[model samples]
Target: MPDPFDPSPDSGDRFTFGLWTVGNPGADPFGPRTRPRIPPTEIVAGLAKAGAWGVNLHDNDLVPFDASPTERDLLVKEFQQALADHGLVVPMATTNLFSHPVFRDGAFTASDAAVRAFAVRKAMKGIELGVELGASTVVFWGGREGVETDAARDCRDGLGWYRECLDFLCGWVKDQGWDLKFALEAKPNEPRGDIYLATTGHMLHFIETLEHPEMCGVNPEVAHENMPGLSMVHAVGQAMEAGKLFHIDLNAQRIGRYDQDLRFGSEDLKGAFFLVRMLEGTCGHPAYDGPRHFDAHAYRTEDVDGVWDFAAGCMRSYKILVARAAAFDADPEVQEILEHNHADPDGIGPILAGFNASNLAALEELVLDPDSLATRGHRYERLDQLAMEHLMGARS
Candidate 1:
């Protein structure tokens, strides 16, 4: 048998990593930098060697925040050359809105008008860089766009300011005629007490109110959703259903903890399995065709080699789970249970489809066995157990 975990270049997994993710210097809140930073060119080469299809970045990840124009041009040129030499693409890009001290309070939602203006300008530059590098998606993670205390500012004002910024950026993209879309990322709370639009569901609704709603979407992260104990699978499903799943961040985290950013499939095997099933369309929905970006970091204890190991592990784990989900869905018992559960003997599909006059009359005339329906078990226990068995390699 062939090696299932092979990170072969021809593999269909369009896995990607951010320059910041692999180049993280093992620094955290308590400790100083443990490893030296790797250059963007070297990071690209590493990712390509490990079988990654593309790389992602924050503007500052490649060019320093205060670099002169000449310096910025040099850095970008070098990085682009590295990408060409290594056969990699830049799929997504974002701005570092949370790292600088000027964004201490917030970026787009900052109380200071000047601060908000500066944030928008910085985002414009980030968008230009993304377009220059041929990225089709730009993600916005409002890491500090919230408050520790509700007394800071009215959330209504914050939301208005947020909407203004996104609307302005959407208009700017339209003027430039770049084939780019904005993806808003959500986080419950970490750097701040509470972040506005704190979940994928919130982002979805917010996008609808945008000036160019069609060009906006949500980039839901596994760790961000899992931090709040939300189901990542459902969150992605909602985005997919709404035709807004433009990108995704695949990482693992322990529920109710700080953003762990663990390797994919490390902590929650079952969740990851079903997530793969959904993304691969093993659950009967169309598969999502977007960059499977891993916005995660290696353990604080890992060195340079371990960082590469972590990157490779993420891609391999995703591929392994893909195979497992396919096998689980193909199992005879699993299909039978699903078919039986979905059996609509009363022909209610069209009646529930809409409230037409004839459909309503048919619905009113339909009879349901209330007592028997309430007692009919879904056999989900057995189905869930089988899922676990497949995930655990206990079943073929």
Candidate 2:
């Protein structure tokens, strides 16, 4: 329910999309074998050419956590220069907390204090890079924050370790005097049986307890929500209503399965469409300051280009949804229907029955139309015009 007459903000019109590239571009999915790699600079250029507003580079991309100082410094310089050359901004970056063998037990959640300390150091480095690159946010995905076995786990100590790490990181960022928001991306279970913050609800609880309103927020990935048998649109709507949706990550959800990171609209098209509409109808016109975060696993062999294509399509889809929602808003007859529905829910059947076949046909026509803007224009303006004409003649 946005104001129909309000001018769309520049930020809303400029839809930003991000690319998530962490691991080997051509690494085997089922095995640990690596293949020939593409340069990260080429990836950045490709994304910029494909109409992305920014990129989400991982800490590992800057320098593998275990690399020598010389190697790390060189890699960081190369990435920073490439981003500048391509006019790509880094809105967010993540720590490499999962890939190292030292994190087999966990990184921040490890029972060993030394391991936990090492993880914190790595995260601090990543945060520093984010600040240096002028990123708006930094993400911490608890990749190893889970237990494979219930019998041998020290739940209390593990939880304590995680909180400590988060508090320390937040405090460090606050001390820096940066306006960077720290986002916690939640997943039900992957790489572990139960992640520390497994759902939006869990994340909310943690944020409330932490009480660091300026430092923390949730980044709900669409696929992750579906993995836990929750509706993505519903979950996002709940977050929006509660004023907790600071950012979002778009990917297709495989019904009743783990995170797939498939192309947008690949599996649950209805859900995807609704999500686009919700984002537009709510966040689009107002101009959200946060980034459109992405957590895409490289599913296609084309590597970087494929990732960009998917991200671009997602942004385009959202734009189309926004335009359509605006059309619906401009239609007086449609507004009347909505208003009447609000006033008298039980009276809807009789009113709906009046148009019956024609109404059903018009809906199908509008939804199935190929031309995006034209379809919306016809459905909203034309349908309302026809309805108004009929109503006036009947009254006469």
Candidate 3:
């Protein structure tokens, strides 16, 4: 890796991984686990050795589903020991609410009161782990928070239930008085036919209805945004502009498809280019200082070694794009185009003052003639070609 502190740099200690990514074993709805189930500590150790700065995890990733309280303590103890030995930390934690069969109907919007209560308790446990591990935030991806058919329940009720659950969780965080925050991961669909709060804008708007809206934000996932055929860069840009980009999930997906969870930069390098440029301040925004957490999983075709490669590749692709972004900014043509579009501080000073009725009326005939003024169009194709060339280091 190039030294990040150097005058010219490529990478830095800004990469984090989800423990589930390295341990997924390439499982899917149609398939079983292909690789052996590795222990939690080993996963953390492997990620550390593979160059991950830290990790985030779903609650069940480290502890067994039915782990006793004593067992939970032992597991957290071992996990913390591994972290101390490897110099790693947990930046975020999430509850695995969509996996269990009980959540088939939904967690927060379950028809069964008992099931809904159970989901809430499970989330509280997730928060407990986050607090114990000193996580900066807890993420909630409502994978099954909606229904398959319109006959099942009103979507309004689902949204209301979601807000209610969030209100409780946010209040719980405050009552605990820990310096932790919560993020809502918006997925268009997958485990369920439709997911409530299925986009960045939906969740951001929903937060306003909550009593503790200030405690919640969105952790927009790239693949999720791409699944709905939305502009991934624009979605992230909106989150950052709203100060609700509490965390991020970096991954790849083909346009208008299932959630592939492919490795970052696998399918859309250009989209990743603009996304990284946004985070790196190549656009006129402040650079994001939060964790670049990879919430992606390995392909079902991959083996154990492939899993590690996918994990490392997330950071590698991000660094390469950062370099490309710097190159894009320093290019003279790009600077010229940006400057041409920029509103100069001096304003159209004397020009606006000269737009009096007399001269304006005298020039009406010439101004009204379409052929009199030549069109000055934006050379967007040229700019796009420039970006592509720089992305591939082909600026010869």
Candidate 4:
């Protein structure tokens, strides 16, 4: 059986994992601040042990967004020391745009200039800290960049405010010479009725309009995508192809519920497998410049360990996906389908007809024959055996 952990040429280069600890140690995602079960250091250590490349830290996790300079400074120093002690690098950090009540109207898109300025100032401080901590990217998920009542508000003006805010924020980052990227994560509607950049395509269009190479990019979240009835695989593919897929936020959701950041692979295994394929098979090999930001909502009550377990499960699922994709690609029938589809789009009708009537039966046997040497342990082994059999006659 093939080793699922082995890295292939197409495997992802920078294996980034995020720690969404904004409300950790005490605070739950919804409410009720519990006692600290595990310290932050242990979480970092566990991530490193689990083969993660880096960690994503949120602004609140490091310090209160509205803290005094002296307080902020102390917290910054503490965060830096924590990272150094654990040998964990922060690839990204997000502003505390969602925690405070002042952002009810919106953060960057607030109609009130005062609120907008405060939000920007908060984000700038977070960016500076992220730079200090050697983070590669600063994420901006417009938690409040939406409209609850569009009837009273001028939609165009609101959108204009958002673009202006992004331009200003992104420009500041570029001027800092921080070698950092700005990732904008989009969610359809949660805190607000209608999010400004609610989809990957919408993000792409916005980024193109920004025209700042270092300014903006999309961080597509799995559950976020699924919530809007979008296919995760297609979304990832589109982002990759557009050269705008700057970061990734992985999590699962209940098919049609609110953004539930469940553990990876918890929902839609086949879809999750395909997402893995898109990440490894396509996005991994390229000189893809970005981060894999985990925007997870801590679903379990165990706190830190639960988050670590979720991250580990994500990695394991990634392994399964890569293995299966490799095997699928190796199959002659699959290859034939791909080639025919690519070479002659109209030829698919005739090409598929060439397969014998018993082919489905044979394929089923190949997939389910437990005693078969190929049907052993890992999913990779089974897939590889099936592919090999398809490529080299079944009798062989």
Candidate 5:
């Protein structure tokens, strides 16, 4: 019989990693790089060997930021050969608008018109690269699109500039007839004092205001959401509910800290279990069918072997969480509690379904005992304890 705890991943799992993630050199703001850089080709080979379905990247992750046209082509050709040789694929791509000094102020929201134009132009090239690599989604992480103070630029102008940039890019993609979509990643702060569209919910609402709302979605990172002491599961659920969860970044982070980007399911085990349940729809709902991309890196204290270990651990943790979540949802006790909590014995659902004279009348005529309702315990404590047991392998 197959081991229930087996952690081996396969292509069918839809697991992916970013070149920048696995290839990260372990550099932090307080120290120099501890690990040597791993070339893009080598990264691809390693990921395939690790049983990853696909890889992702930023424009600068493969080609140099200052490389000439000929150099860029050669680099891309070599990377493509490596991917083909290893049976790996590119699922997503992004731009590095933050790294360059040109975006010191901001990219799309830059006060300098030339800087904004250059940012858009660079995004166009990044989009072309992504489509060429067969990526259906391009993520935009506006790392520097914020201000240290309100005096830097008017918030209204910044929003208008951002809108214009996205509108232009959407039109460009449509004109080229490329099968691509944009996933905006949000961060409360880090590279900047405060970032625009600071959370997944904010991104969802912002998407609706875009000229090509349907062509835009959000890429929620676990670490990014947790940095602000928010619930990653709720953020993701909102995105999924709105049908805007185009892509996701699986990693861990401690609350009230920098973006740690630790291994998946490392810090918030309970949160991770719920997140897996939501994504896999183990609790009875449609699952999110998208690449489970790990946008994380190894610790600075590790060597090359440790890096690979970190990679494997991320996938292994996710698989384990998935199994646990399934077990939790399938538990008979859990099922009973959920059914009881969700029981609409009074049949108030149909009446509350819409707003109309008849429905309003039905709702108005409804008789209920508030004291009885308040006195009835939901048994959430028991349900939560059951979940923990499942997650900890205490119950199966």
Candidate 6:
């Protein structure tokens, strides 16, 4: 439904995108990167002109690993200047621990003591960078913090190591007096057969075990959750309800497949629409007010222009879905359906309250009363049709 040929309109502060989203060569393990590497400063300029108020990145994405102290300082200074010139800000920053060879075993869960310590240091450094960049959230995506086989390591030790890592990070933040929060990201399986914090539920529970639970939250990515065919809206709602939805990544993926990181609304429009509604909806009172970063990639077949189009499309599609959701709310028929039959049965409250036998009788009567039951009319097919019409822009 996207018009790739349309002019790229400014999204204002409605969205933010990751620095890594641009110029992806679409490489795999066996293939090499084909897209030209654009400098991080240039990338910031492009995103600013594209109308993003903020950008997210991994530390190494903007700052090279092999740079000397002076070189790193120069790089950071240039990046800071670029931000000032373009009026852009940093929403989040993360450590790229998995890409380095030292983390072949894992980052936080590495069995080797030196490797584990180095991973911790790298993460601390990444947090410092985020603080310097005025970022609100620091993300930890443990892509390499898992084992290919159970026999390769002990699960207890791995969990303990992960706990130690998070506790240290939390303590480090307090020591530095930074105002940033940590957003822990999760994926079921990827570089490893099973990731340590494998889902939003698991991540939330683990966050409670941290030294500063108040400073820890989850950064749920749509594609990561959808990889296992999870209801993206349900996963996001869980994080939002807990008031721990620190950040979000918007992307698309095929069911039960690799982390494709497909363009937004490329695979699932209904799912995408519902997600936008839940995030931007007033009825539910969305708990998150952070940037919607498009952590997706361009297809291998596309060129540089296609990459820009992909970026524009990400913002445009999300804005369109948000508008459609607003329209859905304004529609009188939709509101009528919601008021009449979208919620739990009205008789349920009385049935669940008092334990008296008379109350039980009343509950039974409510169920047996054909007239009351018949009044609960759910026009699901029509409701779905209404949403579809909006999605297609065919209200007529």
TM-scores of all candidate predictions against the true structure: 0.98, 0.76, 0.90, 0.78, 0.98, 0.91
Give lDDT tens digits, candidate 4, residues 215-255.
57778888878998898778778888877677898778877
Lowest lDDT 10-residue stretch of candidate 3: 2-11
Candidate 3: the clashing residue pairs are none
- In model 6, the clashing pairs are none
| Per-model lDDT | 0.93, 0.68, 0.84, 0.69, 0.92, 0.83
Candidate 3 wrong stretches, greater than 4 Å: 1-11, 344-374
lDDT of 1 by residue, 1-396 (tens): 867686765767699999989999988999898888988999999999899999999999999999999999999999999999999999899999999999999999999999999999999999999999999999999999999999999999999999999999999999988889899999999899999999999999999999999999999999999998999999999999999998999999999999998999898888899899999998788999998899999988889999999999999999999889999999999999999999988688979898889998998898888998799999999999999999989997
Model 4 TM-score relative to the real fold: 0.78
Q: What is candidate 2's CA lDDT for residue 198?
A: 83
Error of 6 at 29 (Å): 1.9
Lowest lDDT sum, 10 consecutive residues, model 5, at 3-12
Residue-level lDDT tens digits of model 2 in 294-382: 55655646554565556566655555445555554555676665565356433334445556787666555543345763543324455
Candidate with the greatest lDDT versus the true structure:
1
Cα-lDDT of candidate 5: 0.92
Please state the error at residue 379 of candidate 5 in Å: 0.3
The lDDT of model 3 is 0.84
Error of 5 at 305 (Å): 0.5
User: Model 4's lDDT to the true fold?
Assistant: 0.69
Least well predicted 10-residue stretch by lDDT in candidate 2: 387-396
How far in Å is the alpha carbon of 231 misplaced in model 1? Answer: 0.7
Candidate 3 residue-wise lDDT at 348: 37
